[model samples]
Target: MPIFIDGHNMRGISPTDLEKIVNSPKDNFGITHLEVFYNESEDKLYCVLDAPDEESVWKHHESFGLKCEFITSVKQIKTAKDLKEEKFQILGEFASQLSHDLRNPLSIIKNSVDMMSIKYKDKLNADIFENFAKMDRSVIRMNMLISDVLNYARTQSLILEKYSISEIIQASLEGIKIPDGIKLVIPEHDFSLKCDGTKLQVVFYNLITNAIQSIGENNSGEIHILCMKKDDIIQIDVQNSGPPIPDEVLPKIFEPLFTTKDHGTGLGLPSCKNIIEQHHGIIRVKNNPTTFTILLPKDVEKLSSITV
Candidate 1:
């Protein structure tokens, strides 16, 4: 039986648009089951490809400015589920239970911080106040983990929305406190496309954030963005100057919980993959020893205003 994807209300377009995305090259990877993407306006398509292992998914999608994860079981090929099942798989279940159980202590810490604020109202040193803030950040990180587990355990139930692609990137930059020294190189031309704001934001954010992190503190790099119209489709390329992503590690970057960063959740990039696939867009990441680039081809209605 064909996998009946039920994201009707999720997409901000018509069913016919989705049918077009489904017919794109990426959707017909000829695999028993694979991942594909569509544009919010329903005009473009991209493929994530199917491999015998999860490592390949990471390597393939990463080249497109997207991310992926590693799968250890045959059940992973099924479209209905992915990383979500792993959250409750044997020992994974216990880990989640433990993370959830720790919430009580985090709440207590927050409460204690509140109490200290009151008890030392006027006498609290600036240093002490700063410590409370530190504690707060720690609590937030823990909560983030719990949320990741839950999200991973569930199919994002992809809530696709028709959104302006260009605006999403700008919006992401606006809200994020980008580290200093890294400069964002905006495209010289105006380009617009449609996609889910939340998911697409993740896609741009992860790529941009990764570029900044690659150079570390005090180091500066130029991040360039190129958005253009290729006939009826939209193509986006984000390039950064930094150390090249090692050819060996490139393939496994998308696997869940796999990360080169010590504190990485390994979910940001993977989540990006899911969102792009749903949008009927293609994403690829590449490097030339000193520069890195990501590619995304999205499908959206060719508006007269944008066509010229």
Candidate 2:
């Protein structure tokens, strides 16, 4: 069986409409729909189908009044598990490519806006200046969302190495602006662990950034980070002085695409979860003082030697 993948620009199409069209009879098109990749954010769909030829795949979609942008034959290396893994990789690649493409135009717009702001600030009225500021903020938010999506999709196959807790925390804090009213307290005890330092830095970065944002503007707060080791396990806790998450929303905090922040992409905590689990660890959150705790194994060297 030959597997063919085709992409369609499905702008403004509903899920029900897509389902009905895909399930409709082929009418001698000689193709079987295997799976669909729909991205609501981009209004695009990629369908994998089993077909006798590329024409059959084209005719199949055309019969349903849909036009496929492109179609290509793909090789199957293994059975169901391999197909699933390949599908995930394909999705990640698509997301990464789309994000990269979008950044180019966005970068141009950002530069134009910056130049205009600098060149016209004296001539622009307060209202125009405010509007420009708003647009810049929106562009920044969009960039952040794209970054989070890319990170969430590609958070796999980590390169592990030895790192000190203090070093990881310091690296994570780099480039992040901390509020003057907020105080970060880190434990003086230094501990070493064998893990993916880069990915772990992202984990701590998300937690620390979330803590800072939770405190909001003009609020004095303290973030206390502590690390401990007992036997073969090491536990790290990040406690922040901020309002507790709503009881109902607590359970869904780590769920993908779930968020409470107005401009959040909702992938931060989910990415954190993926990174932590990829390291064979567990993360938990509690509310009395708003703490996020991560437990990582001390003996990662042994686990790293075993083939997955």
Candidate 3:
């Protein structure tokens, strides 16, 4: 069995009532509530439990008419108290330092390429000029890879603010150069969401970039972004007219370091998943015409206050 820590907003629920609920018999899902922690001032409750999986924990909470803000899988450290730090924390620190070291040289190379391109444009042959262009692109690609690594390794704090869906999407599109043959359709019915706008921007940027790449250069295609609000959740779908992803590849698309592209770092989708999960939301994909759907809670209070 895996252990999970689930947080809930317990406003208006008394400690006595919560205890009575927790003491009730375990449900048929085989979930065992191991421990409970409550903060009266914050009206926050955290439950440590042993369960089959995250979904099982979700179902267990749903049965109690409670909504979990976030559910995280964790391991209990019984022996080494000093080694309680998470492996990802170490990896994040190392990745930050490594990115800093690598970017210094990368910046130099990029500047050199730009200067050479301007100084030799008239002197170089078409083939040589094309090679310079490729070099410049490679530098840009390397920079993006470094950013992906940092984004995945580090757990960033969300700076929540209210922003319209259309505003965020437009901000994401500013840096991307859509091909001439492709058409982008954005939703006219916009909804405002309180979230980490910068993180959500990264999610949209990666999804749109992937969509454009999937359509391929000089290929005519349409990428449509749709947004709708239903009940307490807001759903957004990014659909692209690209070839269907293979069945085997579909399941692993969000996995880290999994990619079919030769030059891809494979961190884009995984980073997007991490950001969505941090927001206490869900992201899924469907193929027939290749659509990625994201479901986010309309009420930001459902999200845990813990950064990332």
Which one wins on lDDT? Answer: 3
Question: What TM-score does candidate 1 get on C-alpha atoms?
Answer: 0.50
- What is the RMSD, in Å, between candidate 3 and the native fold over all Cα? 16.0
Residue pairs with backbone atoms closer than 3 Å in model 3 (clashes): none
Query: On a 0 to 100 scale, what is the lDDT of residue 300 in model 3?
Result: 71
lDDT of each residue in 1-308, candidate 1, tens digit only: 22212122223445664464445444222334445565457443444444545444444344444322232333324444644655436535665677678879888987887788778879988998867767765665565455455444444454545666567778656434455788877777665555456656656766777777786756887778777767656666777778888999888876677788887878666656545555545556677633333333344322323322
**Candidate 3 Cα outliers beyond 4 Å, as residue runs:** 1-92, 100-147, 303-308
Provide the TM-score for each candidate, comma-separated. 0.50, 0.56, 0.58
Model 1 clash number: 25
- Candidate 3 lDDT over residue span 1-308, tens digit each: 78898788887667666876578566547876557898778779988888888898877767767788898887762445445445546766787688868989999998998899899889999999878877876775666556667678754567788888899898777557788999999997999888888778778988998999999968999999999998667889999999999899999999777899997878899888887877778899999899999987765766443221
Better of 1 and 3 by lDDT: 3
In candidate 1, where is summed lDDT lowest over 10 consecutive residues? 1-10
Candidate 2: tens digits of C-alpha lDDT, residues 86-146: 7867877887788878988988888898889999989999999977777776675556556
Residue 170 C-alpha lDDT in model 1: 81
**lDDT (Cα, 0-100) at 103 in candidate 1:** 77
